[model samples]
Target: MKRILPLLLTLVMAQPLGAHPHVFIDTGLTLAFGPEGRLQRVKVIWIYDAFYSLLITQDMDLDQDGDGLLNPDEKAQLTGFDMQWVEGFNGDLVITQEGQELALSGPQDVTATFVEGQIVTTHWRDVTQDTAGSGTYEVTPYDASYYTAYEVTLPVEILGADQCRSRIAMPDITADLDALRQELFALDRQAQPEDAGLPNIGAKFADKVVVTCASS
Candidate 1:
């Protein structure tokens, strides 16, 4: 696993400058269910934006020919580069059912590829316990400091779960930003907006995947 840079970790935990997203990713989710209709695992896909991809490739000296595609050797070198999760990192994914958060194992079966000048990665996470039969499960991806923005642009797939259906719930950015600003103002009346310590407002701007299962 690659260890996250210390400066990056600090920025992610406490963004004193303000809560704004610097990197963007198009996220995809695939929920897997066992034969008994219980939730088993989740597959997470991340396609990074072109600017970030360019930075990564340039930093790593990949695609030297400037063709915008990585060869087999370069692809192999890029695999699992983001898997080096620091301690207590959650991979920016949150899964909860009935208002209780679920435990998920660390990333596994990781793969990475560069396509169309973007870095695309996929990994699977096993649910530590059974969680599907009835009720709704909410899967949200977010960075607490709002440094990375994730949008559910790809298709949400339900695999081996005929009794379950999934839908995307888009958040209202304008309203959420307004609420956050008010809260920040309440926190500090004299300090400037940039100087006030920003709260963990990433979830407010996240797109949620709501999974509903028919009761057995």
Candidate 2:
């Protein structure tokens, strides 16, 4: 009975965890200008995470007293996580002031590269021991995409010596910002390598709102 039970357990664990559904969300922003400060620019960030898991079968040498899934006492160290894998990673905004809200999808006059962005990433070989890895060959630069930011400037006329920038933004990412940190910890505990996309990945995120001029 004991032997049969072990086999059944193994079979059950072999089944896949099933597919993860995709959910899309957008962070909304609003800017209100005051008579004190000037609104410079309004910014927003859209983050998406899509994850799939893969199982790796490692050779376990029990006869030789190997302690891990590796050949011997070999340990794996991870320096950081890459968040660029998320798809549809782009965003733009329509500013509304007083009672006028500019429509992005609606037919209207839109100018400049406000909704467009370019990505840049820099990387270097890093060893966990705070020392070089064997020889220089041990290190290699890993180029990866970093999340891009959406930026738009508020016209300068609104800064007429008396108006101070007053702003109100919707779907603030600060709370989710805190939640994502916790999400990563949970994924690690589950030993979920593919779950990496869920942490820095945003359910929905928005930057601050700025109220400025109507020209740009």
- Using lDDT as the measure, which candidate wins? 1
Which pairs of residues collide in model 1?
2-84
> How close to the true structure is residue 168 of candidate 1, measured as C-alpha lDDT?
94
Clash pairs, model 2 backbone: 35-164, 36-163, 36-164, 37-163, 37-164, 37-165, 38-165
Q: What tens-digit string does per-residue lDDT give for candidate 1 at 1-216? A: 124455544444353433345578999999988888877899999999887677677777899999978889999989988888978989899999877888899999999999988999999999886655568889998876556789999989998878789999998758768888566535432333345556556777789999998887
Name model 1 segments beyond 4 Å from true.
1-19, 174-176, 179-197
In candidate 2 the C-alpha lDDT for residue 61 amounts to 17
Which regions of candidate 2 deviate over 4 angstroms?
1-91, 98-100, 104-147, 150-177, 181-204, 212-216
